[model samples]
Target: MLPPHRARRAAGLLAAGTLGLSTVFLGAIGTAQAGPTGWTFSESNSPITVPSDVCSIEWTITGGAGGFGDTNLRGQNANPRIVTTVVAPGDQYTLVPGGAGADHAAGGQGGTNTVGQGGGANGDIATGGGGGGAASLVLKNGQVFLSSLAGFGGGAGGGAGGHVPDSPSAAVITDFATTPAPGVAGPGSITGQGYACEALNTPPPAPEISVVPGPGQLSVWGRSGGPLGPGPGVAPVTGYEYSLDGGPWTTVPGGATHGMATPLLWLTGLVNGREYGVSVRVTSSAGPSAASAVKKTTPFERPGKPTGVSAKVGPSELTISWSPTAAPGTYPLTGYQVWAFHGDEVDGFQVYLCEVSASVHTCTAEVPAGVDYAVYVEGVDDKGNVGDYGWVNSAVVPLGDMPATVPAKDADLVGASGPITTVTAGKTVVLKGSGYMPNSTIRAIAYSTPTELGVFVTDENGEFEVTVTIPGDLPAGAHSLVVTGVDPQGDVRHLRVDVTVSASGTATVTEAALATTATATATATERLPNTGFSAAGPLVAGTAALGLGAGLIVASRRRPSA
Candidate 1:
């Protein structure tokens, strides 16, 4: 049970609340003091929730009409509005309607108060003008749809004595179909509805990204965005954004579009042997697409130097050993190279002994006895990178040995006579020896000088015979001949012969001259044995006769004997 004017005000407040225009009405109305009555709507209602199926929407909205008044104080018209656009569902929006203006309060009556028991007459007071209405708006999908300006309220009637005329309201509202326009200063009223939308525009798909790793960088490429169904409405891709190792994304310049080729982008400053994860996304006029899948890769480098190189020397052989080197990248060690050098000369000729597998750490090389050598090793990786040589190792081969039992022997020298210990300058001598290593080399040399007399190989019995020509210019003195034997194992043994040489040999009878004198004596002895006289008497008689005959022959030759 409320007054008619109050009930109408309540109904207007409810309509403003339904359109979300209560806040604007509160601001438009003045303070509710004794001065004048001002119009106001209720508080704003909850926002409208759009359905998910809806893609586009159309809206038609109007502002509140101005309040009514006397002939001189007519109210203004309401604001006009309209909107249409594409939108996404599940979005919330607000709608606002204009509030009506309030009428002015009535003027107060004139009164007389007692002053010294005599009443004083006072003039009638005029009332203030009404307040203006507030503007309104309709928002769809977080965007403005239509708006209206405020309208002014009517003025109060004139008092009894001071006749104050009512003020006129603002003019009628203009068409706000194109854009939201403000309402005039008049009564507040609204009339509009929302319409269903058409189909929504399709978005582009996510890009496919790939990465290729090089020496210290990575190459990235992508493919995204294509033409729509049978029309010109093709989603256009502008560029791409990339993230490294789950870091912040960085935008690049180019991207693949409909009926276009994709380009690669090279990124540098990457560390070698490090793995990286990368992702990409494409951008278009609508918005950005989802991120692509992660791509993994790693940069590579050469292997490092080997370690723990060592060499062991055996008789006529060298054994080398070392540890395998490590690679800094994904490549694995493939093999090892073993090398040998003469001495400390590394840059000289390097003898490539052998190539061994990565698992094998040792290798052997055949070398000459009693020689010095230096060894080195290197590692090779699957990526074709050769590591530096390891530390140098010195190796020395040990000497070899000959047979035993070569020291003592049956050593003797023989000349024309049997077993001569001494010899003249022009005499020829024969040397005989036994108890030497079988199939070994035997050498006869002059002990005083470096002259080699003869060289021979021992027979199966370990015996050798060699003819040596002693130099005629050899000094006439005591000299020693050295006989040496060397076995297959490179062992050595020596025998010495002491001999004496005379300065002169003119009176010495050689073996051939002695044999001739002996033959003549044997013939004379045989003739005496045939004559039957006593062997001594015949020989004595013959000797005496030979002496007498020789004396007579001499005399006859001297005296011419008959």
Candidate 2:
């Protein structure tokens, strides 16, 4: 007998195709070794005879091919088996290649009574099963040397092995019989026999999904693939699977309504302003359909409020400016919205000043004067989302908010009586005023309890004629009508007319002292009468007293002595 090390060396040389070295070891062991030879068998029940000079044999065995099933359900192929066995001269062995299974028939037989059975069939519909591979066995003087049982073929629409298929094992050497070990089932081993039949139902087509983006979140809207297939076995979508950014899939139950698109899922815990890819697949009893086309969207939030806001005021125009806000996300910043509130915070009126493009940081708007305003700014995204307002500056009174002059030095007003300065109380009268800013807005105000009567726009000659109605509720007292406007130099110009207010329906012209007190406690509000004047053109650059004949005409009314 050869030493154990020499025996191992012989096996290693034999596996490496070193036949000369193996022959040396075989000669040392007193056995003449034959040159290596390979054999392939496809037929069933073939016999293999070991040469008289051989000491070992290497065998490679393969199972037979599986049969095909109807509706393009092909059977799985078998796994190959390989082993090297120590043998004596003139050893006897047999090769039983499993027979190929036929469509709608029983599976091929394996060595030692192992068989792969076929699935059930209905009329012309059939399923196939694959054949089992040959087994490996070696016996010396009734003592076991190495043995491996053959594996059964796969069943139709079942795992790679046939239904109830037995497992195969690698060759082992022992004095007694070696039990076969279990293995993971081949492809399709866990499936039912009806797995192939379910293919009659068509898969769902790729769907069109919509996405609405929000702050660090995305809302996906989708619809069902609908019922599909030609026969009664038509499959309805039972669930849906979604993937985000090409990540793992998540399954969600399907709704009852089909074909109509609606919000179905919301993906959160995402970074803002980052784009992500999304896909969906519909599932049914038949399996999952092909994935839908990829759609991309980005989550975003409203822009930050503008900072460092400031404003500069002119006669009736305000120019506002601010610093840039935070950078935009998926939705770009479209513009900035500027707003202002007139008067004190308690009773202020809000107004939308203007909108400026995101590329710009400044904008100008037309604003009414005579009252203080608080200016604010906010950012707007491309999706029309508005941000919080940045209250930068307040109490921005325009240049037209100067003190009211009791009797303007460079302005004049005349009624139908031609410069005669007597007026009745609680009556309607037409008065023409000149010597003011060209194309400027003029306000008729009643004071000591300042009340706004009407507003009018001056013509190109700095003149305007407006019909005025004295307030009927005014107590019989001395009062003055102050016509205020902005001059060409952007200075406030007030034209005052002093008069006595009498009771209604009485033309009693009472001679009263000139009212000189000017207060801002205005309480009465009235609508402006419609003036039949077209829009004024560009303002003419001239003095406010251009048409004044003598510049100062003091009309004094005296009561005649009875």
Top candidate, metric TM-score = 2
TM-score of 1: 0.23
Model 2 C-alpha lDDT per residue in residues 28-143, reported as the tens digit of each score: 21222234544323224234445544544554433333444444344445444444434544655543333333433443332221222222112122233434333333323333
Root-mean-square deviation (CA) per prediction: 50.1, 33.5
Per-model clash counts, in order, read 18, 7
- Model 1 lDDT tens row, 276-327: 9988876656566778888997755444567888888764456888877764
Any runs in candidate 2 off by more than 4 Å, and if so which? 1-207, 225-234, 245-248, 253-262, 271-274, 308-315, 319-323, 326-362, 368-376, 380-442, 445-562
Model 2: pairs clashing at backbone N, Cα or C within 3 Å? 153-162, 154-160, 154-161, 154-162, 155-162, 159-188, 159-189
TM-score each candidate.
0.23, 0.33
Cα lDDT of candidate 1 equals: 0.43
lDDT (0 to 1) per candidate = 0.43, 0.47
Which candidate should be chosen as best, given lDDT against the real structure? 2
